[model samples]
Target chain A: MKTTLIFLVIFCTSIANAQTLEVGLRVQKTQEMYWENGVSAQFSFAKFKPEQFFLGLDYVTSRLGTAYQSNAIKQDSYLLSGSWLFNKNKPYHIVTRFNMGYFYSDLEEDMFAAIPNTSFLVSPEVGLKYNFKKMPISLNLGVGFYIITAKEGYSPGTLQPLYYHLDLYYSILKTRKK
Target chain B: MKKISFLFIYILVTISFSCSGPTITDDLLDGEVVFDPSLYNPEQFLVSAKYPIPTPADLNKHIILAVHGYTATTFEWQEFQDWSVTPSYRISQVLLGGHGRDYNAFKNSTWEDWRSSITSEYEKLIALGYTRISLVGSSTGGTLLLELVNSGYFNNHLHPKNIFLVDPIVVPSNKLQTLVGIIGPMIVYVETDQTAAENNYWYRFRPYETINELNNVMSIVRKGLENGMTLPSGTYLKVFHSLHDPVASTTSSVLIYKGLKTSSGSKIEVQLIYSDIHVFTRLNLRTKVTLLQKNNQLDVFNQIANKLN
Candidate 1:
């Protein structure tokens, strides 16, 4: 309840200041050779500034699937991140993001003598958003380095894995009347 | 750049080494035990035994006590029965309490009922004059066996000779039980398709309240450990797990292996089977074949039989 309230407060504050909201779905595949594929939906609130900069808050919920032996590995994650657009006007926008999140996997039940648990992932990402000149659509390509930490189990230590994502979105609601 | 290049090289080498490591052959045996559905037909796909025997014999020579996961039944062990000959040991397919019977019976039973049932089976085997026992348990059963040993139930001069654990539920924390207790039983459908049946026989687990019972089972296991009893001396413990099994992760095996005490007199071996399935039902065939060829299982039985002789 406390966490939800804090989140709601931040969301309300962000919406009041930003006045612009964007929501879209994203497909991501981990660049780590041993990892699997993932998909997520992201909701962002941002405000464009006079200095050609943009600041936003993003919440993403994602699912990842992997194959192990004869079984399928699935995980669900929720991430909250802050994004800063280095340049907003160019056809390609460069954005930097920092994220903190929790991930739950069904496999945790098997840990012997340990508590069933969840993992925390902290990541910093850099990406490019290429806007289609004529259409209100854009292609986003990004890479993030995540410090994966497991809680309450025999984790294989903190692994820094490379994650890559691509998203294509068509604006359903424009921030401006034009 | 130099450090980065070295790290890349190190990773490549590690991958290569793992791939080239001794191919853990499932080839522990040759030939197959074809399943004749007619020979051992299940009376009802799901029904309780009308005539419950107070003491079931070691009906087969190569006996394996097969225990299922939560809300599971004896039928889950049927897949394994087909892969072997009428061997030297009788396989005891135990239907845990609150399962394999009327579903309503579960609501009235506690986790203690399940524990008592397993202990009774163990005592029955001992009374039958079978000196050697091997346990093949999965998920919840795995935890139960570990607890059984820690509790000193098997600590006497004679006890189970070996244990085979598949995805034992050993966790570092207890919070998941609460969450699972809240939501685990909402699922009611059981997969009846052939493939689904083959893969997941115990599809319908007990409700969330039962999850609390499972938590009780865990507590008993933990208490046994604290009491200073260890897995029986010279007993062999082998664990097999898949990397991607969503129901039971590979980490479970790792944790159990870590907690298990290995005195010089005891032999414990842990093998993490790399597979993509929740349960390695397919490996059942390989296990039977391996036992048949090496006759390792026979040798164990023969040692017992010789004493009888």
Candidate 2:
């Protein structure tokens, strides 16, 4: 179990090569649940997969989307992910990624303090990314299933397992003049 | 070719098992029970049925329609009826349509069909000149009540005086519950592990079709909540949820608080019970009852009874 955890940590997170920083927006929807929209940021290091590998952080919440002057629960998710591109130098690439994060849904009242409103988030995702060659912009479409860490009723009800996201990223720097 | 044949045979056998139904001797509600007792004699279970003609005094008494969850019959709220020994209010246990019966009848029923039982009973009381009427629903029963409010069902009818929800399910705790369509064909139906006494009250076998209906109503209510819903003028709603309900998530109550508003645009009251049982108000026929559980049940019961009086 420890080895699996370590392997997952290594496979899904920070390892470096070529340097390019991308910051953007994420539009997310949980299956049959809430619409959570937020921001995303990614960066990669110097040699070994170059721009093909990226480590990212994302923060999404219903407050900005479905809960905006609406009745949806106010919840937030913070995720750290490692994504690997299937193609080396292409305008379009398939992306396989893994993420680990935390989730919380504010019950707003003190009476429900004991109810499980927090959970550790773990998910594996697969998607497609499209890069605009002339402009340093990219559009990504991804779907992910959260690996539920607790018993069914022990997790926050609004934190459903299946979700899809579409992200738009703008490259702030070149592939580090490789 | 031999391996392919073996795989095909295996798949066929699995499918056969999936579609298999219980035998007559299974001693399960799916095969053993003809129908819920309330269906056979609603007059004995529903106040509206028993007192079709109000005595003017009967019309003044508050009528609380008690609705049970998915697969549950009028038996779920039997304890409340037995406990309420006062004339200030009455209990009408309306069995949802298509429940407490054989598997086929259950498989053929829709959520709308299930909710009709509640509507028909409510309409009957209204037609009988019972002006003081309230509603109490548990689990999916609670969901249906909220749906009624969300869909504006009370617009044409008399407004309910008070609505009490116990462990309503807006979002299911079982994450795979969302994927029933994909897995339903292979699974056909689900059999719960319950005692014999429970079998006489709740459906032992849950058909995929009914599960789909459950999902459909939940989806409708959730979307409506997203858009926001309000109670009728002079109506009051309060949701009581178990802190760690195994069947329905506690977040359901949170949604109820956020989405449903009282007549004056104020947030509805929501209380998280200290127990873990899905419907803490129903302790009858349970295998083991804890003191705390009993206290929780009595607490809600007394609270409801007090409000009625």
Candidate 3:
């Protein structure tokens, strides 16, 4: 376990060398859903397209406040996202994002292991972003819905589909000088 | 560019308000009566009412309190009363606090008021010295039952013999239902696309206030389920759900099973039937009833009857 942890950290730091990378924290407030808090890391591989396109990844958990602290239904989600920004030079940009992810929730009971409570999730989002000129920082606000594809009784009941989030990002690596 | 941006904002606001549907008249009693007025004339509907006295024979039989869903009246369980041929049990159909009247009554009533009706009847049965008592709730009724268990109401009061839930709305099957809290202000009331017969029993128009109340209580019970609840000692529970309930999600049963345990820490009982309708146990006055629907109702009825016997 110790060796695996060291290797995982080295791998994550190496990936930060991508042309443009932004690592951030995300706070999400769901509509009639639970409060989920998580960390976000995003990078743009488009040396040609520059800031217009980006690849993002996020891991969110409700365990911080509601699930692990209060309720037994602890949920962890890891999402991979692709995004498009309509304007390149403007400080403020209109953004659309598509995300795909895997979700797992544990009821903390041995008897419920038979229920299919985990699911694959797909979501589409729309948001606005502001990039600060002086400071290498950005903030984004987005709303999205999970297009739950699971049949009835196969998905977790607490995992509703609609949510809005705020992302505060610090620029780790700037877009390659063009 | 400014013109385009302004137009976009205007359209978004317009759509938000448009989705709320329509508003009900402010007058709380502005609707036609659906059930026989004579039934509540002397308050015979309420088991606590002095008009109807339970004889020694009535007290000997098991008492089952039947609760309906949101915006519904006692008529939701009227079919059960009509079809129950055996004298082994008696059905006390309860009209939720704000229900069975006009639209205004529901608009102003809170969830607590709606729950009071069930508690009142249960206390009445106990006061009359009845030992065998059970509860059957459809939709929101089931949510309230779960709330009762989570609050430890039974541990303090008389422990019920059994609790049966049919298509409870812990998690709604309709995705749009969750948005009611956000869209409620613009759409003061939601209109139901129901036939005249259905309207007579269920409120044709649902007030946003009541919808919020339902959401509030459902959220409480849902959190309880997530944390897991222990059934009151000596009480039994069984949840019956349709495979594809269009109103209440089938996941509701799954949550109950996962989150709730019997007094002895055993998993609660659950049964899933094959049907696509909401409240599958209420079979009266529905359009285009199918063989499967009838069978679904009988299946649950037999289960409850056997338990009573």
Candidate 4:
């Protein structure tokens, strides 16, 4: 994992020297009230340029309470994403991102035994982020829809109904290069 | 160049913002029905006997036992009442053990316990004077039914007149057994619209508590697989599988079709539906099209009813 992270860091840095890259730790409080704190590093290949875009990755894990009678549940999700900044001319840039990733969790037996529980989710998402020029931070607001398929030993012929998620993230390093 | 960039940004923003249409509010229920988890007996996992009273007073009609996939109660079939408008057949939704009422019942249960619960339901239906009985198992229930049929237990109990499986899991023991052994027991959390926190459900039963029972269940299911056991001849078996279901994969249905098809005649028919979701019942039009194109449960049941007559 360390080696991979290093390789990614070097690869992202080599994209464009004129770009401003920010590597920092982020903590996200999901709608579920569980805190997903992780290290997320982002590299903007063409900051302030017309044809500018950014690539980012985030790994988050959290344990939250279930509506069911069980005590607590744990989930590990990895996100790989790329976003295109459409309007760099304005102080507030409109950025749209597409994320492709997977999530794994170990559900309680009572829950798994009862419903056709899906352990993994494979889906894509699109979101919008608004970067403010006055502050060194950006506020990201986005929504995602995912369909989870059941795995083996799980209830088949059952659908994990389409679920929607609304997220808010505060960027730690949103700065323009000199 | 600036003008071109501005146009590109305007188009992208328009497309992104316009992608999602206004949320539909028609399906919203007028009143909220607060589900009290404590009212029902946890042991009686099936639906209340009063809600879905079996149709047809004649006990001689072919009995069809329907089991819902995980995390769901017999209430899942409440929507099917309109679709199953036939009188010659009776459908009983079997609730697996450790579901419906109490969430903790899963702590003491194994896969065998669930199978036993289903078998007992079958026995109850048979004892009620139904001569011809068909098993229609969905999701995990489908796995249980397949394992039971493969075990040769049902052969003596009345010879399953037919078996209808929807997105069954025929090969769970091989793929998930090892993971359970290592993990001991894990739980997954599901988020609800009303709840602030996600609900946690166990992924596997505790090893020390139900290890022996699980091993026994695995061994029995495995033996049936190794012996090349197939459903008895004259026993009509139909499978309705979803091509895009995330939980029960299309491969699972294919395996069941291969394992349970008898050589005597065309006793097995497999229908693969291509859809955007897993279970088809909850989906809207496009998803339902995928489900119908693959296999219609009502159609399968009617065909079996005709043959029996």
Better of 1 and 2 by TM-score: 2
DockQ score of each predicted structure, in the order shown? 0.04, 0.60, 0.27, 0.05
Task: Assess candidate 3 and give its TM-score to the true structure.
Answer: 0.82
Residues B1-309 of candidate 4: C-alpha lDDT, one tens digit per residue: 999999788777656643533232222111122222322542233322322344445665766777766544465443454456676665666666654433245445677667766787677666655577777766676767777777678667877787777766433312333233323322121212321111212122132334434444534543454344577756777777655555555545544543455647343677665443445553322312544543554554455456545
- What shift in Å separates residue A30 of candidate 2 from its native position after superposition? 0.7
Off by over 4 Å in 2: A1-18, A176-178, B1-26
* lDDT measured at residue B109 in model 4 versus the true structure, 0 to 100: 68
DockQ of candidate 1 compared with the true complex: 0.04
TM-score of 4: 0.46
Which lDDT tens digits does candidate 2 get at residues B45-134?
999879887798888899999999999988889999999999799899998988887788888999999999999999989989888899
Pairs in steric clash, model 2: A17-A45, A17-A46, A17-A47, A18-A45, A18-A46
Model 4 stretches with alpha carbons more than 4 Å out? A1-178, B1-57, B171-178, B185-223, B263-267, B282-309
Task: Please tell me which predicted candidate would have the highest TM-score against the true structure.
Answer: 2
TM-score of each: 0.47, 0.89, 0.82, 0.46
When summed lDDT is taken over every stretch of 10 residues in candidate 1 chain A, the lowest stretch is: A151-160
Residue B192's lDDT in candidate 2: 80
Candidate number of the best lDDT = 2
* Cα shift from native, residue B57, model 1 (Å): 13
Please give the range of 10 consecutive residues that has the lowest summed lDDT in model 3 chain B: B21-30
Task: Give residue B93's lDDT in candidate 4 (0 to 100).
Answer: 65
Better of 2 and 4 by TM-score: 2
Query: Please, what are the lDDT tens digits per residue for candidate 1 over residues A1-178?
Result: 4544665676566555443444455666543222444433333443445213433333332223333331222344456676667666688888787777665544433432232335676889899888788987777788887664343223421121466777676544345422
Of the true interface contacts, what fraction does each candidate have? 0.05, 0.74, 0.24, 0.08
